[model samples]
Target: MMTKLRKIILIPALTIVSLSGFFSCGVDRWPEYAHQTALDTWILDIMQQNYLWYQELPSYDDVNLFVEPASFLSKVKSKQDSYSFVDSVMATPLPTYGFDYSLVRNPDIDTAYNALITYVIPGSPAAQAGLERGDWIMKVDTSYISKKYETYLLQGTKAVELTLGEWKEVEIEDEEDGNEGGDGEDEGPTMEYRVVPIDEPVEMPAARIVEDNPVHKYEIIESPVKNIKVGYLMYNSFTAGTKAEPEKYNNELRSVSQKFKEAGVQAVILDLRYNEGGSMDCVQLLGTILTSADRLGEPMAYLEYNDKNTDKDATILFGTDREINLDLHSLIAITSGTTMGAPEMLIRSLFLEDVYPIATVGSSTKGQNVATEQFINEEFLWSVNPVVCTVYNSQHDTYGAISPATDLKVSETTIDGSTNYSEFLPFGTFDKDGKSERLLKIAIGVLDGTYPPKDDKTPEESATQTHFKVEKSVSSPASRRFSSKGLRL
Candidate 1:
């Protein structure tokens, strides 16, 4: 392969390789030699022909021959392509330890950090372990959870021994007498670290918890000050199901939309803060569901393929939905760094189709304008989610990440490291449900003038606010990019 490639003078544009040899019958269907180098060569060949930015590939001289196929693929693609990568569809989305978390840089000590418990999946190990939202994980298995590289062990570890921390109020020290500070005002609570006993041993194992309810929440909230009723949908992903039929997943979206319409929803708040994108088919359907009948059959996005597959270019139009013209027109979409792929597409499509302006709040989205094509080795055992095409809205806008109309400092943030954090209370929390969920309240406040509206910021501007990039993977898994085709229950 090297000799043939050198003969052809391999360059950045020489990404296309003859893939006819990949197909055959029975055992021969697979490549005969089947070495790691051969596999990587095959991947490179396919990518050159299919990757949206084929011309951006590294030159043959720059290719690292010793790296693994997946790692090599990462190196070959453009630095701008954050979403394109290889991974397995088989690895379970269920956390090994049955807990999901996010790590934030500790502000007090810049060298340290904290892993705040984001969600304790209902029956997951974290929940069963008595771990709740807002718990700051100070250490896992005696390894301090700091900005240090070793802290990543928590995500890959099967069993985690945790040293937890909770916020507790502290009295301020006065400058003169060391009592209550100069003013009488009390200082805020601080994070005191300790270990908490779980139902199981200190260590938790990887397992699937109660799987349904990925749709964390869908509630009709009534305004406290005004006589307006609002709908809020916390859509995590656009999956139809993990193993169930796509129809079942579609029904889940339908059910939520139906309830929102029946509840006489005046304005809607669509939350896609943590979503890492999913199926384009689902995106098309969601665009239809969110849009009104007046815009039915209109183009939401145009999917264009590479030069070799231009025939696959398509115009995805908004389909008709049951709740055609509900009082919901323009909506308030709460987004974050993880807001990407299909969710980003949905927001951009809706905004382009003029169904309504999706007033995005929070951070800028994961700027992934490209979609992956599901491919596999001849044996079908190894799958590859390779970037194959680009998507543009009706107006031919290829926005990598949809910027928020208003920038809001509402996401969880650590102030002075272990001292304070903006703990994100879940939707529908008693006193903090509607106007309480940090990001959601910003949307309502801006609309109703309860809070002053800040100037709309660009993606670059909003990105400066966050140290961590909102994404799904803590690190590359055995085989995973970010999104796997699934039905979101």
Candidate 2:
């Protein structure tokens, strides 16, 4: 849906500089106007008028506005709200290891844990050191993984030594199996895998700013079925572009869709397993690319603001990017719990008028059907991106969590008969040896009508399944932060 930036609500400048003028005298130069109270007052004023849950806001008298803006906003915010937040406009971006990791307790060693590399950005130090998604980190510096070292993986910008390891399955014959001659069981006990450390430690350089392109990878895949070409796009974020080139990434998306159309792609798969969400402008652009021309001018989705700001409520309509629009009946969205905010809105919008359906695969989404507008006080170097409205598809439906049409939460079996979780493969490739990276494979299956395998669990049964356990997960700062970017309009 093409939705333009409708308005910019400029709060009266109540920043430190403005207050500084009010406290001009030497005797009482730092008066009430220059205190945290004024800043908090400014924040409250905006939230009360624009926040989606304005009615649930705490009374002004009950909040301790003397506290820092972050803490003060937290105190006054509605308990139901999790996406609203205040950020320092002058804050520097956090340097990162460029790889996400999840910690899992080592069943073989009591209280010991291992870090599983979740995903590594290309050209990052982790990739330079030859780390892949399935790799493991057994120790951090000299400390083995324990409660004390559980959070070491998240120490952004810190130089650290990582002891690499591998997950291996060792067959342990059951003492009661009695294969020698007694009543031997038909099969051995379930196989188990253990993490074994490598001999040398990897010297991980200090975290640095790694340039990540939201348009990670795109390709035209030739399906096994004759006369069918599938477009696979692994999109990690919804960012439009940098300040210098606002439409840079959006232009790239247009190029990819044009390529797909030229290649006669019959189906498209959007892999958003790691996307946490970003600008709604990009969402509208991508939605337009996937929708059919006949669907153009239809309501893709709409934002519902609080009563005080009902005038801001707007519907995003599907528009044509004539050169690239695919006009497909349906498309696939590969999602995980990390997919949220604008990405969720994009997924819901695909169901526009029920004329086009989105076949979502993988795990449940993060369920953030809300959009935020950033209010910046540039003079004071502060900004607040508060959730201004709840988003809904044309059908007026908002999901608690967007469950996948197919779920791939089942565990893999090791050679020793124990269960081990499968790891993500590099984008676009399927594991012929095993079922790892099943999300993309299943999506491809849907296009070929071979999905669900006729033997696999139904979507309903799979929805109740739980992912394999990990002690803790650590994604890049952007992946963990909500409303990191805002929908401009």
**Largest lDDT belongs to which candidate?**
2
Local accuracy of candidate 1 as per-residue lDDT tens digits, 246-297: 4666678778778877888787788887677777767777777677567877
TM-score of each: 0.72, 0.81
Residue 425 alpha-carbon offset, candidate 2, angstroms: 2.1
Count the clashes in each prediction: 17, 7
The deviation in Å at residue 383 for candidate 1 is 3.2
lDDT of 2 by residue, 84-127 (tens): 77766634445667787787777667888878887777777777
Model 1 residue 54 CA deviation in Å: 3.2
True-vs-predicted CA distance for residue 439, candidate 2, Å: 1.4
